[model samples]
Each structure stands twice: as C-alpha cells, then as structure tokens.
Target: MAAQTETVQWKLGEQLYQNPLSGEHDVSDFIMEGQAAISFPQRRMRMENVLDPKLGQQANFVFWCPVEFPDSIAISWDFWPIREPGLCMTFFSAKGANGEDLFDPSLAERTGIYPQYHHSDIHAYHVSYFRRKEADERSFHTCNLRKSYGLHLVAQGGDPIPSVQDAAGPYRIQLLKWKDEIVFKINDMIVFQWHDDGTAYGKRLEGGKIGFRQLAPMIGEYANLSIHALERG
Candidate 1:
C-alpha cells in the first residue's frame, strides 16, 4: 500500500485560560506562553501549559490539522503520567461541523461510552479504542486496559475479554485495519485481532480525529505526547 506523511509543530491556539490573583503582582507573572518540548527516548512531543493567569477565563489549545485516510490508519501517543486517576487521552470526530458531538449523548449512552466516569480509577492508565454508531442506536465496540495493564478488546454486542491484572504501561498502542481484519498492538506486540465480519459497527469503522482527555484527581503529569495517522494504499 502507498502511504503519505505530514509533520506538525505544536503551536498556540486562539483561546486561552486565565487565573485571578488577590492583589497586584509583578508584570512578568502575567506573561503566558505555550511551549512544547521533544523527547528523543520516546519519540514524542511534550506540551506544557503556559497561559497567563490574568488574560482570559478559559484556556483553549487546539491543533487544527487535517488528516486524510486512504484505507486504514494507526495512531500512537507516548504519554507520561503527571497525575494519577485521570483520563490521559480521548479520540473525537470532527464530522459535526457545527461543533456538535459526533457521538451524540444518545448514541454514546446507548453504546456505554458516555458518562466518561465509567472507566476511572487511581491506578488506571490505558489506551481505549471504540467505533461510534451512526445508524443503529445499539451499535458500538470497545477495548480497555485491564487491571493487570493487559490489553482487552470487546465487541459491545459480543462477550467481553476476561480482565487481567498485570502492570502494562509506558507502551505504544497501534490500531490498524486490513480488508476485514482489525488489529490492536502494544509496543509492536500484537495483543488482539478481530475479523470484521459484515457487522453494523465493525463494517463502518474508519477515519476520526484523535485527542487527549485528562480526567480528575490528576495523579501525574503527561508529557512526550505524539499522534500519527498512517494511510494504506
């Protein structure tokens, strides 16, 4: 298959967040700037919060890059935990041009991907993959990181993968598809693969925007983040 490549240097977005202080402070403390660093060991980009506390009410950091997929694509990010018990990442779709959620509350709730809090814990750290339903309200699929840190994939309509209790972290996750087979890999290790039979959810799996979601109890800081979209020719 033929493939294409694109590289993006992270930059400041149009929106930003601001904090209020009790009294007047030095002008330098009010200067805010967004910064990104690179780590060679992990081949990822680390983004830092550098917004001034007195400029705005909310911080909006957006990377508006367009990604086109020919067949299938693989997305990977190297995340270092800065806080515990938080959601380190999230993948969203821009299909709703009017700023509507592609996975509406109804579909998300029906597929068991809504609520967001359903998958949270102090020691939880794993990459998740799921396909949202555009037609049937009951169509969707999900894969989670087991307590043991092992990879667990499930077909919402099918049986779930028995949870394992192993420490699996600091590893890369790859989601790829070919013909009718979908594969999930960790650190280049094939953890799970499924036959994409002509099903409502599996058959329609293709193309989406990937983003990171940080949940509460902020246990650790996240750094060295990276995202790549590879298309098969």
Candidate 2:
C-alpha cells in the first residue's frame, strides 16, 4: 500500500529507446501539435512559440515522441530553461479514453489547448514541473502531478529549479512509473512520489506516448531522452 521509506533499489532492464534530440533527424518522426517553433542551434532541441504570446493560450503547443512505451518504464531526459514565466509539462501514459492511440485520427482535435488534453477524450498523467507562469505560481514554485480525463491534482512537491537568471545548465530529470506508483526526480533528488489507488482517479493510466508541452512565451531546450524497462530489486 506504500513505498518503503528507504532508498529504492531498481534493477533497470534493457534500454527501450534513446535519442540525443540534438537535431532534426532525432525528432524527424515526432509530432508537434500547436504553433511552436523547434530548432537545434546549440546541438540541443529548443522549443518556443511560433505564434504571438498575446494570443494567450492559443500560442502554446505540445511536441510528442512517436514511441509507445510499455506500462512499467523509466523516462529520463535533460532539461534547460532558456526563458521563463511560462509553464512546462511532460505528458505520459497518454491515450484516448477508450484506449486509442494518442494521434488517432478519430480523436478530438488538440491544438495546445489545456482543456483539450485534460477535459477531452484522452487520459494522461501530466507533470507540471516548471510552473512560473502566473504571479501566484511564480511566488510559490511547486511541481504538480495531475491525472486527467479531468484535471485531477494528485501530487505535488516543492520545485528546486532556480529562476532562469540563476539557472546553471542541463539538469537531469527522471520520471519513473513502475506498476501503480510514480516517482519524479531532478538531479538525482526525489521531487515527489505517489501511488495510484486506481478508483480515485477513475483508473491508473498505462502504456502510451510521451510528449513535451510548453505554455506561451517560454523557451526551453531538451536532450538525451531515454526510456528503460524497470524492475524492483
């Protein structure tokens, strides 16, 4: 019913997928839904808005990896905050409510709209790790994990990433989903961990696509996306 309040020993299995995300070839198969510009000027994939920020929510977007991972896996990536004052999220275990592929043509149109992903026909677990958008959010920095077919805030933890002016460089971020539990870490420090009771959030999500989503006017860089099979030791 609960994780052992001690160091978790995981025997990571075969690497499922790996990408440097260094250039266009690495993401040639990726799908971008919304109006975001992507480039690799620094050998790292940079994401920013193509639309005017004054468009508000309409300027946001999601860039999705084409891989469909299994239920129990570890997703690891490197993150760099270039410019701030916007939210950044990672959506995993995303699929249609009835278990359709994330990009299925039958699925409702999604154009970086928040409600389209959370309130529409899809079910996903999204972690908002860099939340500095609004005035209140900037005042108190916290990483929030939400389960949706509805935006259900299930977990939260204090965010450790500093402001852009104070940020150092590529920070390692990892998200582990093994069975019914989820753990999020940054720079090898556990930011939050949660167990899904299932019934509370309808059902625990599993095995789907992973995507990077950014709110308007924010710029960020990403690299070294890797997913691995995980076994508890």
Task: Give me the candidate number with maximum TM-score.
Answer: 2
Candidate 1: how many backbone clashes? 16
Per-residue C-alpha lDDT of model 1 across residues 57-133, encoded as one tens digit per residue: 12212222233222344444333443222233334232232333333343222111222322321111123432121
Query: Which runs of model 2 end up more than 4 angstroms from their true locations?
Result: 1-8
- For candidate 1, give the lDDT: 0.31
lDDT values, one for every candidate: 0.31, 0.90
Task: Write down the TM-score of every candidate.
Answer: 0.39, 0.96
Q: Cα RMSD (Å) per model?
A: 15.0, 1.8
Residue-level lDDT tens digits of model 2 in 59-158: 9999999999999889999999999889899999999999999999999999998899999999999999889899988999999999998798888888
Model 2, CA-based lDDT = 0.90
User: What value does the lDDT take at residue 190 in candidate 1?
Assistant: 57
